[model samples]
Target chain A: MLVCRDLVKSYRNKTAVSGISLDVEPGKIYALLGPNGSGKTTWMKIVAGLVKPTSGTITYNGEPIGANTKRKIAYMPTEPFFYDYMTIANVGKYYQDFFDDFDPNRFEELIKQMDLNMTDKAKSLSSGLAAKLKIAATLARKAELYLLDEPLNGVDIIARDHVITAILEAANENSSIVLSSHLVDELEKIIDNAVFIKDGSMVLCGEAEKIRAERGKSIVDLYKEIYA
Target chain B: MFKLMKYEFRKQLLSKIVILAMVGILELMFIYGVIAEKANTVASAVGFFMVLAFISIMFVSFECAFTYSKDLKTKQSYMLFLTPNSAYGIVGAKVLTTIAQVFLTGVVFGTVIIANILFMAAKYHSVKEVIEVVQQFFKEAMQLDIQMDLIVSLLVYMLVYWILLIVIAMFAITLTYTFLANAKFKELVSIALFFLILWGVQKIAEFILPDLAHITSYIMLGATGIYLVLTALFYLGTAWMLDKKVSV
Candidate 1:
């Protein structure tokens, strides 16, 4: 389980994440629903140990997030993160080199399923293809937790389905997944819980179907209601 | 740690190739000029190649200073930081790789120079004449003793200075990224912090050994000891900042 308490992150000019607290239970797919500047990315980066919180502590299974926590957390950033010289094969090798849980055969299978070439350099791929490649590489890791920020941002509708299925296939009962995206309707089907944020604070959070039933609105409607 | 060093070396693949090629070409040119019995041409080539080697080594060290900052700026760093490596591990791997590189470059260049010296002896028939000229030059110009210990100390201090610059530069870079928001201010702080840290290191070293009045050897050895300690401290400080303060 991932737990954060009163997390606050601020820059010299502004605070990106305010006093927000939350828990991520194991064996569930969670949708971190928020628009731009809603602090979703900052929160996820904090959990991934890429960003340090100003005044709060984050723990995974009772230990503070550090190098050990990193091994169990796989993060896929919204931006293309591979070096320019890295090909698909090189990316797989890279993950295999660093991550003990990374399965190259699984990566190869995902690459085939996504119709991506092994010889393609990561920087040269189209945005959609790059997104697919990112998802494929990230999902191939058998980590305890996965935080995928904006996984569906640049993907087309056809590729979006493949991406969602890939994510679903990656999850198991021993792990948890947190996906941050603006594609609400698509995520509503797979997400078990939804956490809504607005302007660096949580507006609402609960089980996906329970919140929908109680509020008498879809996740998309709730997102619009919270942000707009 | 070695795994990280493997990738670090791989990253400098092109630069290494270019450096080695330059060394090989310069050595071959010097040998050819010697065999051709063109004394002035050989002298000019040796002078030019030494200058080239100096510039290239300085350039490589300059590049090493920014290696960590470069990794942080690129999203590719996510691949590295996400691994189970601590910030110390990450920083140590980089520093160690740089040390290994400098050592390798020095060894290769030194080998070529030794080969040339032996070849010169065989061709020109004059080790004593060469020694006389070098002794005269040192006595007249440098006014320093030529001894085995002195030579070793000179080389050791050179390597120590190289490492000090890199570690201090890294500390400055990481500090700038963590503390300052304005890009201009960040650059300014980095530059300012470098000089300040260097001055601080010297002052502290001097302050700790104030009673060593006239012993030049003791002063040199003492300063070198302080510098090694400072390097280790700076390495730890940089790693701490990366772990505790850096946002990415």
Candidate 2:
């Protein structure tokens, strides 16, 4: 479980995330929907403890996020996060070396399922393949929470389904997965909960089906109404 | 820490191998010219040293700078910083790897040069004469008491100097490269800003401190400690900026 209070992140004179708060529970897929530069990535980074908030606090299970909390949270950035020279196997090895909960066998199986060559350098892979590799690498870890930033962006339609499936397969009853993306339809069928963000603030968030039932509109319709 | 070191070691192994090979080739050329009794041997040896120094400095500086810059530009730093490791560990691994590379290269090159000198002397000059020349050179160049104990102390000092140089160079490279990597204007603006800051810092230090040119060697050792501290500060500052300010 995670909680953020008045989280704000700004760069120089521009505010990226302006005082957003939310609580995430276990065993649920929380889809963070936002347009470009909506501060979804910034909020995710803050929650993951990768970036310090300009002001506000983030707590995981009632304690401030730190080394212990970091050990429990797996974060995949928007960009391909591995070294160029690293092979898929080495990337798995890296996770295994850093996180005790990393399952190399699972990572290898995931790579194989994605049809990724274990010996191929990350830099040599196509963008979609690279994105799959990153997703596989992050999901292989047995962390309590998984924070994926735009895991489907630039991915082919077929690979996008595979990525979504891989992410779904990686989830467990005790773990929570937070995925951020603008592709609302792709996430519509998968995410249990949806958090819609616009201009660095949460416009709406609740159970995906219930929000639709209550509001008499789908997540996609609501997104257009909020932003347009 | 060990994991970090292993990763860095693997990352830098190729660069280290290339450097070693170049050093070995230079050593062989130096020895061959010396054994053949060519008058230009010493000149060539000195030239090789200059080339070696240039290569060493540039290779290490550029490699380090590019590594730091690429992390920011490519957003690979998020992977590093997001891990459950301390910022100290990340920066410390880079610093240690750079220092280790410099140390290994210096040891290999120095050993080759000394071995070549000894081999040449054995073939063409007496051991006593060689010892006398070494003693005279040390005495005249350093103006120090040239006892065995002092020789050991001098070796220690030289080792410290090598470490100091690597630390200072890495610190400067990381600091400049981080700013440049994150800044909007890529060409002259960031570079000019980097150099201006460096120049300003140097000027301030010079203005506040006594002239180092006239300082005694022993006093210079103390000053070198201050330099090392400043280098450490720069390293910490870099880590702080990367950890807190820079967005990936």
Candidate 3:
């Protein structure tokens, strides 16, 4: 499980995550629900150790996140992150070199399922293809925690399903996945833990099914109710 | 660190090919002109390559600076920071790659220099005039004889300086992105800071060693040592900044 307490990240005059504490457990799909600039990405980045929290503590399994914890965390950024010179095959090689938990065979299989080729250069791939590749690469790792930032943003309807399926497939009894996205409808059916964040603070959070039954509304309806 | 350097080297692979190809072409042109006894062609080739060499050196230094800064400016950084590599390893690998590129470049140009010297010696049947001018220039500048020890120390000093330039450049870029990250004129501030630091280092060196006219092996070795230490410090500072300040 990943735990963050009193997490706050600020940039200049703006506060991204304002004293927010969150706990995530294994074997469940988490939807970090938020609108654009609602501090979801910043929170995820802090947990991923890509961004340093201005004032707070984030621990993975009772240890502070650092180079060691990075091995267990797979973070997929919203934008294209591979070098321009990298081919899809090279991307796999990079992961193979860096992450000991990386499964090359799984990566090849996932790429095939996503309709991505090994020979395709990362820079030349279309946005949808790139997004698929990111998911494929992230899922290739047998990570304890996966932080995916806005994986469904700007994706098409069909590709959105592929992404959701990839997320589901990436999960296991020993692994937890934290997926941040504003597109709640696509994620509502798959996510078990729903965390609604608004204006850099968590507004609502609970078990998806229990909350739905108690509130008498779907997660998406709750998203609209909370944020809209 | 080795894996990191492998990717860094691969990133520079294309530029290396293009630049080396140009160098080969220029060298061939120069040799052909010499065989044909075409003075104009030989002179033009030398002039062109001189400019190319300067540009290439500048490119390598800039690439060294931008390699880390680009990670901050572009999303490409996620690919790196996401790895389990420490900031020290990431920055160390880059510095090593820069050194390798610079070393290879020196060897290539050194070969050309040797080949040209041999060519001119064979063509003229003597290097008497060239030797005389070189010796005269050294004597006048240093007010001392140019011994083998002096030559070796000078080479070491220059090599140390080359690495220092790259490390300091990376340090400056890291400082800009981390400290003045949100500043509207960060780039401009970075440039100014680079020059200011360069001048400060130079002034300090000049202050410490004011008697360059009485050059000796010990003096040259001391200067090289200073440069080496500075390179290490700058590299460590750059890595520390990346770890502590830069978010991406």
Candidate 4:
């Protein structure tokens, strides 16, 4: 479970996130819906302890975001952030060394299932394969909360299913998955909660079924209704 | 902490290997020249190694700082900050790794030089004369009394001074990255901060110790103490900034 209050992040002349607050509970998959630069990644980075918020407070189960919570919160940034010299196997080894909950065997399985070679250099991987590598490496961790920023982006249509499956496999009764993507239709059926954000502020947030029934529209429809 | 250091070392493996390979080649050249009894080859090898040693020291001294700056500017930093390690641990590991690398390099160079001296002495059959010549050279060139104890103290003092250099560079670079992260003149600011800190340290040493010119064991020990304290302070300051302000 996680809590964020009045979270705001500002750069020189622009604020990436402004006065956005949300709570996340366990056992659910959250879709952080927004267009590009809507502060989804910034919010996730704040929660992941990668970025310091200008004015806000974020906590995981009553503790502030830090090394302790970092052990339990696994974040997958959209960009390919692996060392240039790392092979797929080396990436797995790095994760294993850093995170105690990281399962090397599971990482190997995910790498194979994603149709990736162990010895292939991460820098040489195509964009799609790189996305799969990020997803595989992230899901391999048995973290309590997984914040995946644009996990489905750059993934091919055929491999999209594998990535989604891997994500679902990582979720359990004790775990929560928060993912951000523009492909609302792809995430519509899987995500249990839908949070719409626009212009660095929360526009709508609620349970997927409740919102659909109350508004008489699917998550994809609502996405278009809110943004367009 | 050791795990972090392990990765830190791994990150620097390629550069270390390059330095080691060059040193190895030079050492082999020296040995070959000695066995072959060619004075010209011996002189060339020794001359090249002295230059190599200077370059190697500069590289080993500042490689981690450069790595830190690169890490901050690039997404590669996520590889480090995403881990469950604290800033203190991360910075501490880097500092410790640099220290270890410098010490290892010193040992390698020291061993080679000592062996080369002994080998030359054996070849010429003048061990006593070689020692006398070294003592005489030091006494005349440095204008200071030459003794074995003084030499050991000076070597230890140099090691401490080297560490001070590394910590000061790290602090300056961290300050630049944290404060002027988006500034256009980032490198200029970093260089300025480095010199400012270095000057501040020098002034403090001057204030604390009056007679810096005269060579004495007490002054050397006192300077060593001052450098060690300054190194620790800079290290802590860098770590604190990293923990409180740095973002990547």
Q: How high is the CA lDDT of each candidate model?
A: 0.86, 0.77, 0.86, 0.90
| Clash-forming residue pairs, model 1 | none
The candidate scoring highest on lDDT is 4
Selected candidate, larger lDDT, 1 vs 2:
1
- Per-residue CA lDDT of model 4 for B148-248, tens digit only, reads 77787788888898889888888988898877777777778888889899999889988898875566778888989999999889988988888777877
The TM-score values for the models, in the order shown, are: 0.92, 0.84, 0.91, 0.94
Please identify model 3 stretches exceeding 4 Å from their true place. B115-144, B206-214
Best by TM-score: 4
Question: Model 1 scores what on Cα lDDT?
Answer: 0.86
True contacts kept of each: 0.80, 0.61, 0.75, 0.75
Model 1 misplaced stretches (Cα beyond 4 Å) = B35-40, B118-144, B181-185, B210-215
Candidate 3 residue B36 Cα shift, in angstroms, is 2.2
Q: Which docking band does candidate 2 fall into?
A: medium
Complex DockQ per candidate: 0.72, 0.52, 0.77, 0.81
Q: Taking the tens digit of each residue's C-alpha lDDT, what string does model 4 give over A1-228?
A: 799999998888789999988999999999999999899999999998888888988899999988899999999999999998899999999999999999999999999999999999999999999999999999999999999999988999999999999999999999999999999999998999999998889989999999999999999999999988
Query: Model 3, range A78-159, lDDT digits (tens) per residue?
Result: 8888999999999999999999999999999989888889999999998888888898999999999998988876678887
lDDT of 4 at B228: 92
User: For candidate 3, lDDT tens digit of each residue in B14-42?
Assistant: 88898899999999999989889999999
Predicted candidate 2, C-alpha RMSD? 3.9
Q: Give the RMSD in angstroms, all C-alphas superposed, for model 1.
A: 2.6
Model 4 alpha-carbon miss at residue A118, Å: 1.4
